[model samples]
Target: MILEVLQLVPHPDTPAKAVPSVLCSLSWQDAGHWVAGFIVGAPSEALALPTPTRPARTDGLWQRTCFELFLRDPESGAYLEFNFSPSGEWAAYRFDGYRAGMRPLELADPWITSTDRDQFNAGMGAHLAALGLDPASIGTLLSTPMPEIPGAPAAPAQYVLNAHLEDPALGAAKTWQLGISAVIEEADGTKSYWALAHPEGKPDFHADACFALEMAMSR
Candidate 1:
């Protein structure tokens, strides 16, 4: 699923009042894994990023510059939330229902690609070009290699998400609505919310069932 940042709600002090369009894409990996990639077409130039820290689980990563993924369980109505900060800080939270039973969700094999900014692009390019986007975000765990994406760019993308889970009911053959979004914070502390589809009213991502696409597990 590819979500275009249409409603880029920026703060009054936002550096880019009219930030260019941002594209966020998601993929489902073996059995129950997920990979989400985010790229900003507006400004590929380096923005003042938050301080780099060892990749670890930390809360409130979303309050600053971060990328997020939301997954809903059709059977129990439970949901999982993940936060990826450009600084290499990450966090995961699970809820029994909408805004309920909030707790840390242990992530297996979670990794970050933003540690070495210098080689970020080169690494991403090579990773995506060779393996395509399928497992690039997650690493090599695919039982069946993903088919190359036609006409995909040669350069590597900056932000991509990788996650995995195991569920018997919601199998690979069935597709589900995936939510992809980004929270950008400028040097001056201006914040903005971007996504493929934003519902009416405030910038709450939980609403509108923001199911941007019927994404399935495949190439």
Candidate 2:
């Protein structure tokens, strides 16, 4: 699995201090496994990171330096939000549509580890049942071709790397639009929002425009 290195840009209104940049890499593994790595190009002492603690599900992580992932199913408009903190804490939430009907998504806790305050790694696995997806249907969709739209340019066939299609029984093979973002807090309490893409005005990670990375297994 090739990890795609992506550069996250800070919102224009909220410029970063001390933190030079944030690089994120994501790769999918077989059998519902995926890993994300983040490298913060900044002095470890310049950022205000939460103190180390026993890994557990915690709320309000984004208030500090936190890494976030937003996954959306294009067809259904349902999405999952995962938050990983440098302190080995994590949170997961499910939304019905565009932030409606939110609830805690209880699953096996993600394994999060960080190197000082400059680098972090998060790994997790979720079954199709947990995501409310039908494995057989997704398998069929993967085998079928998409209907072309009128006047639209032809699109090349694309699939998520390491989608595990060889074994449809795995049940967690499907397409997803991912939005990666982070909230960086400086030692002096300055906060900046970073993301692959930002909406027009304020730094809104929940906006649809932020979900720009397309990893289609069967779009």
Candidate 3:
């Protein structure tokens, strides 16, 4: 159940005059019965300007920037909030699970690297450690690079994931992964969370299109 970001069409009402320099690419796999997706971006050109301005009130800019994970229940949805630091070298995502009692999942240290499983595991351990999670207890890792989507630019960074987190409470371990992207921003802690939008059409899995749309808004 992997959802890939195949294409991104600008809103018809979007002024043709303002085109974005970057687009998003998304891919995912099934974790248990639920689907999990990773998103990355390909920059058409170097981001020369500051953050783009928010799109028209009609455009669903919020849905694009924020990662929404829909569960079996049609009414249930989990959101991973994204924020770009003021310096623009890092981006952070905070995953708020469906259940209100569950603590939010936060990933702040994001980087690109060769498809090295050991290195990726180490990085994931460090990332979790930063969040006060014990890495030693989280066990049994399997990872792979996301498949390339049609029309997406050559990926500047590769994404890899480690599934099966060991948790005694669930009788079975939970599945999760690490998604990396090209845009780099320093985590300054100023931006709280990315807003969610409900554009006219269905939202795609890719974050790049949403980020690009958000960037365009700043311009």
User: Would you estimate the TM-scores of all the predictions?
Assistant: 0.64, 0.73, 0.29
Write the candidate numbers in order of decreasing TM-score: 2, 1, 3
Tens-digit lDDT string for candidate 1 (12-82) = 23335434545655544443555556665443234446665555678888787687777766656677777
**What pairs collide in candidate 1?**
32-165, 33-164, 34-163, 36-161, 124-156, 125-156
Q: How close is candidate 3 to the true structure, as a TM-score?
A: 0.29
Model 3 CA deviation exceeding 4 Å by range = 1-3, 16-23, 29-73, 83-104, 112-219
Q: How many angstroms is residue 129 displaced in model 1 relative to the true structure, after the best TM-score fit?
A: 24
- Once fitted onto the true fold, the runs of candidate 2 whose alpha carbons sit more than 4 angstroms away are 117-171, 217-219
- Would you list the C-alpha lDDT of every candidate in the order shown? 0.56, 0.71, 0.30
Which pairs clash (backbone N, Cα, C closer than 3 Å) in model 2?
none
Poorly placed runs, candidate 1 (over 4 Å): 1-18, 42-46, 115-174
Q: Which candidate is the best by TM-score?
A: 2
Top-down lDDT ranking: 2, 1, 3
Q: What CA RMSD would you report for each candidate?
A: 8.5, 14.6, 13.7
Model 3 C-alpha lDDT per residue in residues 142-214, reported as the tens digit of each score: 3445677999887454332222211122112232322222222112211112112224444332332233321
Better of 2 and 3 by lDDT: 2
Query: Which wins on TM-score, candidate 1 or candidate 2?
Result: 2
